[model samples]
Target chain A: MFGLIGKMRAARGQRDAVIDVLRETTGALPGCLSYIVATDPADADAIWVTEVWTDQASHKASLQLPQVQAAIAKARPFIAGFEFQVETHPVGGVGLPASEKS
Target chain B: MFGLIGKMRAARGQRDAVIDVLRETTGALPGCLSYIVATDPADADAIWVTEVWTDQASHKASLQLPQVQAAIAKARPFIAGFEFQVETHPVGGVGLPASEKS
Candidate 1:
């Protein structure tokens, strides 16, 4: 599994825009299994995105894409500082099965 | 997939213990696919746990297990307030595949 964790701070009125960008872009990614956007319920300015990509290559490919860069650029001014971490988890090491019913 | 997200506060001296409990207990769970414990690089008191379980049942089982409960009980004193979110992701909805070569 490829995991990414990012933190961003939204500008006064850009919170909705940032969320919309995240929803549209990540939701359409081909290699995405799941992309979770979490916000500090108490602080609308703080946001974190958690994404699982099919592979590092796909994630890397995403980074090189213009749309992704544009999204980042758009959000940069609103963001305080964001760090992204890409990690690979061991397979069959006790992960939930894809077909698990519940 | 079964995912768990938790936030915990660590006492001044309990950082290592919290990490140890996470490493040892989660590493031993039969249904654990991956259990990630992340700390704010700048703040020793803040911690986040992201776990993927084999299934919802397995995750629930983990919660009911004595060791798991005990671990939480031990950490509760130091935690300000922790909330756990259990979410199920839509499988094959563009998630990273388990056997991804990269």
Candidate 2:
């Protein structure tokens, strides 16, 4: 599985801007199998994103797009902090379904 | 937000048992606002779980139940590995809906 997770804190006034960018750019990515961005309901500043890509190469290519760059730049001013992690998971086993598991 | 996420790998022989327990026990938990269990479609060995509770006290209380214990015990043989992380999320931010966001 191609998984990339990013956790970021939005600036007090920039939550909307970040979410808007996330929603748009992720949808545009070619290999984006799943793009999920969620804000911590309890805290406005905290944001978490989980993305599943077709492959690592496609994911890297998406990062080079102008829209993605623009989105990140626009979000920087309003973002308090951010962390990114990528994991390559092997397939084959019994697991839970999205709706029932989370 | 009271969020408890657990990632576990189930044995080939015991996938059904684990899923059964998760479904049953989560439904019985008193303060369980949300309980999600999902398998990585690409990888059968990978399981991702997301749980949102009313509070830590209630979550801890639920863990003490016999059914929960029995379920975990029964599934232990088939589980390759498991990791648990509980985070206390402070409220007040913009987040995405479960369906639209994911």
Candidate 3:
């Protein structure tokens, strides 16, 4: 599976608004196995995004989805910067189905 | 529930060795709900770790475990540097149980 971990810095005092866009945009991706957005405890203006997709192609394809594009448009103003981004090859874990392992 | 998304950069050629240690260290913690160690597709020297724990306290407690301590020591030499680390308060998602949501 394709995995991703990235950090985003929201505008000061706008973390919640950023997450609302994230929550709304996540599931619209067809191959997404899981998409989680979480608030950073240490950084008041940061959030971490974790994603598991069926494969690299699927993840690439997701960027073209209109919903994802819309979410990006909505969230852009709230984003201060990208802290870091990493693409990963997921092995497996709890919560993800066994099929996700391949 | 607590969620953590972090990225670590391994020594130039040591990402796999580091993950071997990570895989061994995870789940030894009592409150670990999920632990995934994935290799970065973009950077051969990077790895992303995604974790779900029962709570912050449990995650703190795990660091004191003998196994975890050993794993840290063993893996320390292979670490190049940390890219980013973010502590998150997780809501709920596909693999995670609904009970995890507070």
Candidate 4:
């Protein structure tokens, strides 16, 4: 499995708007096991997003999906900057596929 | 619920060692609902850790736990530097509490 952990900063006073856009994209992603959009407790203009994909290819494919592309475009104006994006190999977790004991 | 998404760089070539230490600390956390630790597919010296705790207080209290404190001490040598640490509020998701649809 594949995972992504990142921090996205929204344009001033646009945190909620950015989050709403992200929320709309969840589940709509094929091959995605889990997609979480969360509010940053510390930074008012930040959102923390975590995604679990079946594989790196699926995650890559998601970017080309019309909906995802639309979301990226729609969300662009509200994005201020990204703090960091880290890739990860997901072993197993709750609400994720391959949950059997490892 | 409270959430944390961050990337930790392993000292030099200690990625696997750091991951093993983190794995040992997971379930040992009382209020933690889920903790997913993964290797960074892009960076050889990085590890991505996503955590879900019952509440901010719970997460805070965890740091006071002897086991956690020990783990932190034990894992410190293997850690290089943190890329970014973002706090989050988790509403609902699979294997998480309060999963009923909104």
Candidate 5:
């Protein structure tokens, strides 16, 4: 499986708005096993996003989806920067579909 | 929910060994909804661990578990460094238990 872990910083005082856009736009994407958005404890303006997909191709394709594009557009103004964008190969784990377990 | 996202760098040529230790140790912990270990694609010696727990207390308590301690000890020799240890409050996501969904 493909995984992505990244941190995103929102513009000053716009963290909640960025999160709202993310929450509304994410869900039920094809080949997505998990997509979690979280609030950073140390940095109020930072958010972390963790995602698992069936494959790298699936993850790439999802970005081209209309909903995702719209969400990016909607959130662009509030997005300050992105950091620690690491891609990963998930071997196995809880919460993943049984088929994904090694 | 509580979430943790971190990067762990293993000693040279020990990434797989570290991953094995983590995979063996993580599972069925109390209040743990998800614990995923993935290999970093860009760095052979780096691994990314993403975790979700029912609450902050559960995550803290998990460190005291015998299995967790054992795993930490076993993995320590190969662990070179840790980075980007970010704590988060999970709002909602797919693959999380239905009850955890906001």
Candidate 6:
């Protein structure tokens, strides 16, 4: 599976705004297995996003969806920068679709 | 929910070995919502572990499980270091249990 793990630094105290924008884009996406938005405990201004998709194309496709695009635009000002963006190949794990649980 | 996102750097040429040890501990952990071990595409010697649990206590308890302890010991030699160990409070997302999806 295709996966992405990254850290997003929010502008000053705007972490919650960034998270809200991300959460707004969370439903009915094709091929999305998991997409979690979380608060980083160590850095009050940082948020972490973890995503898993069926394949690379599916992830790319989601970026083009209007809602996602809108959410990105809405979050831009609140986002200071992104760090540690790592792409991954998920081998197997719990919470994945049965077929992906190998 | 309790969550953790971390990067584990493996000794040169031992990334897969570290991954193997982690994969062996994947099943039947109570309260574990998601536990994914993925290969980092940008760094050959690094891996990312993303996890979500029912609560912090469950995560701590899992560390004491024989299989988890064994896996940690087995993977230690292959692991060079760890970085970006962030604790998070997961809000909502796909692939989380139904009760967790907000």
lDDT of 4 by residue, B8-65 (tens): 8999999888777777776647777777777776789988778888788988998998
B1 Cα displacement, candidate 5 (Å):
1.5
In candidate 3, list every pair of residues with a backbone clash. Answer: A95-B95
Overall local distance difference test of candidate 5:
0.89
Candidate order by lDDT, highest to lowest? 5, 6, 3, 4, 2, 1
All candidates' lDDT scores?
0.57, 0.59, 0.80, 0.77, 0.89, 0.88
After superposition, the stretches of candidate 5 with alpha carbons farther than 4 Å from their true spots are none
Model 1 spans > 4 angstroms off = A1-62, A65-102, B83-102
Across residues A37-88, which tens digit of lDDT does each residue of candidate 6 receive?
8887778998889999999999999999999999989999999999768799
Model 3: CAPRI class: acceptable
DockQ of each: 0.14, 0.14, 0.49, 0.44, 0.80, 0.79
* Rank by TM-score (best first): 5, 6, 3, 4, 2, 1
Model 3 DockQ vs. reference: 0.49
Q: In DockQ, how does model 2 score against the reference complex?
A: 0.14
Model 2 score (lDDT): 0.59
- Which regions of candidate 3 deviate over 4 angstroms? B9-12, B25-29, B66-84, B92-94
TM-score of model number 6: 0.90
Q: On a 0 to 100 scale, what is the lDDT of residue A33 in model 4?
A: 72
Alpha carbon lDDT of residue A85, candidate 4?
74
The residue-by-residue lDDT of candidate 2 on A1-102, one tens digit each, is 365545688878687677777776665577655554556655667776655555678889888899889878877777888753425331211122243222
Identify the superior model by TM-score, candidate 5 or candidate 6.
5
Q: Give candidate 2's fnat, 2 decimals.
A: 0.01
Name the 10 consecutive residues with the lowest summed lDDT in model 3 chain A.
A93-102
Residue by residue across B1-102, what tens digits does model 1's lDDT show? 555555567777676567666655565675665555655555566666666555678888888888888877876666665544434332212233444211
What lDDT score goes with residue A33 in model 2?
51
Model 1 lDDT per residue over A5-40, tens place: 555677776766777676656646656555556555
